[model samples]
Target: MKDNASLLRRKDAATPRGVGVMAPFFVSRAENAELWDVEGRRFIDFAGGIAVLNTGHRHPKVVAAVKAQLDAFTHSAYQVVPYEGYVALAERLNRLTPGAFPKKTTFFSTGAEAIENAVKIARAATGRSGVIAFSGAFHGRTMMGMALTGKVVPYKTGFGPFPPEVYHVPFPTALHGVSVEDTLKALQLLFKADIEPKRVAAILIEPVQGEGGFYVAPPELMRALRRLCDEHGILLIADEIQTGFARTGKWFAMDHHEVAPDLMTTAKSLAGGFPLSAVTGRAEVMDAPAPGGLGGTYAGNPMSIAAAHAVLDVIEEEGLVQRANQLGERMRGRLEALKTRVPQMAEVRGLGAMLAVEFCAPGGHTPDPDFTRAVQARALERGLMLLTCGVYANVLRFLFPLTIPEPVFAEGLSLLESALTG
Candidate 1:
């Protein structure tokens, strides 16, 4: 009834201006890592809906789950009338997340909701009010999440007086010349100058920072945080919203570290393509929320839970974790080789399929956000979709679907390289 541009204009007037849309290409449908816009144009989706399509769009198992669920039931929220799929999904998450101790999981509708509830549980359990967040972490878009996030341009700009008692400390980045010990010192200083150790409720961080950058947190840093939490009685939270599922070549990114966290937040690929988020953690910490204290009207919709169950099945049945490793390795290797041709490409780093190529001015570390934007635009024009992030906005992240055909992945990478070089 209406053209894409006209429809988008109507939507813009109705919806708030707070949302930042990527190209105006309204996707009609997608399968695996490929998307077809309403105009009937095909584009290789390197963005993957900002890493939410790890299983790829409309994966067969995930699609089947949704279809089957549509025939049975869609709602009757878990809080109102609990269902089997919800409990089963929670049990699976508990077993899957990294931790030896008993764990419990609760679901939500989004990553921000999961993160918010996790903080509430930690605060209630520890009887503390302060939370320590890292400088480059992207928690979510909620008020509390915005407070926890480390960026300022779009995510945190004009968003002030965020949730209280949230303090920030530097996050070590090798490319930025910050060390793990330096981060530790900043935390120590924060405790002494701003928030006291006794008042701290949690220290939440992204295992692999998303939105901010595709920076993988080092194992040493993870282990150090675990130790610090142990000594300070503060709960350590691993926000694996982006790195969860099979994106990081592991079921959970924390699996890369020797230590475990008191709480973990997951979303994005949890329910295949459905919207679902969860907080799984130590049994005791989870129990902090009283029976009536936690839960919402649409907290764990049966349809979404069913889809999550199917997502897990697909991940295992397809061996997507291993697939992620293979795919990520291939992508990174190609980008590394291209570095010689594109002198502006400063570093290529990431874990598994959550890889990124950071760019800078040629021969210098001066971030080249303009070049990054140009490359992304060029890629889009050439029928490849890409996304950018980082505090300086100079990193191009690749989140191709694990189900993407090898040839298709190669084709997208080649186009991307040409864009960078051109």
Candidate 2:
């Protein structure tokens, strides 16, 4: 087996510097909430593949489902030959996602594709071209996705000349100075100066900002958006890519709010590590994009479709939604206790198991990305893997699998305590 040092040399030589890697070692094997490096070092997986393994790595049911699909045949191209798994999954999502109105669901290969197509559908349905996104929101990396994303560095640095009529307003967060009224004022200003409300197609937002920070959207803000959309005939598109599938203690984070979005984009943990995303919405809006306007060569592969079905089954059978709530309370309590000792810890926020801790300079709210890096490094040395995010890069987000064993979870928390204190 190749040692991590030797593999690093090869990786640096063969890959571009733009593709950043967090861990120094390469993975050889992984199970639920754990991984083994090529050199035989074991790690407690807290990253969860960036919120793509909420069901955990290689879940036996998911693996068995994929194996069964492989035995049957892999790809038939749902649009070409079509398969039952694809249709069945769509039916399930339509029934599962928020909104009691008649809904329709379509599959895609990635979150960006789903977001892009949702925009197309919204534009087609409303006969408008403008879209409104929020500050510190992460949609995706594709052209349209980046256009919708609120971050500047790394993501939108040199990718200028993005799609026009995409505007951004502040999202309410106490960590930042932005408030719900401020958010509304910005939107009103956009309508008065940049784009007219009538020309707006959709207003997209994450129920919980992912890469920006694990900031949950206030219920008041959600209701305001719904009201604005209703008043203007604009569709409210909930980008639940990272917050879906019980990550926020519910199937979809929007479920926490009483308002129902016209469209919802979902991916990441949808297929239990397999690449599959979806756009589920009111039937009329979904049908706006004519047949040929949607679909991809590998949209809804049978293997991924099979895995998704099993993932849904596991979520219900394991009672993961409730598990998420329990895990969130425990983690938040532990982290809150650490804050008494770790002066740099600014805030602990999120819903359910989707939580994050932000760091700042001691006795001040100034972001401390350096200290965040130190904490992550210390955690890695102790055999724990953690991920850092937020626009300021001073927040450490937790995305461990809901299925993590009790002892393993406790051990990870102990390691985290050491990381924060040491």
Best by lDDT: 2
Write down the RMSD of all candidates, one decimal each. Answer: 1.2, 0.7
Error of 1 at 257 (Å): 0.3
* The candidate that achieves the highest TM-score relative to the unseen native structure: 2
lDDT of 1 by residue, 19-135 (tens): 788887688888887888877889998988877887888888887888899999889867788888888888899899998999999999999999999999999999999999989
Candidate 1: which pairs clash?
A: 212-390
lDDT of 1: 0.89
Candidate 2 per-residue C-alpha lDDT over 25-74 given as tens digits, one digit per residue, 9 for 90 to 100: 99999999999999999999999999999999999999999999999999
Question: TM-scores of the models, in the given order?
Answer: 0.98, 0.99
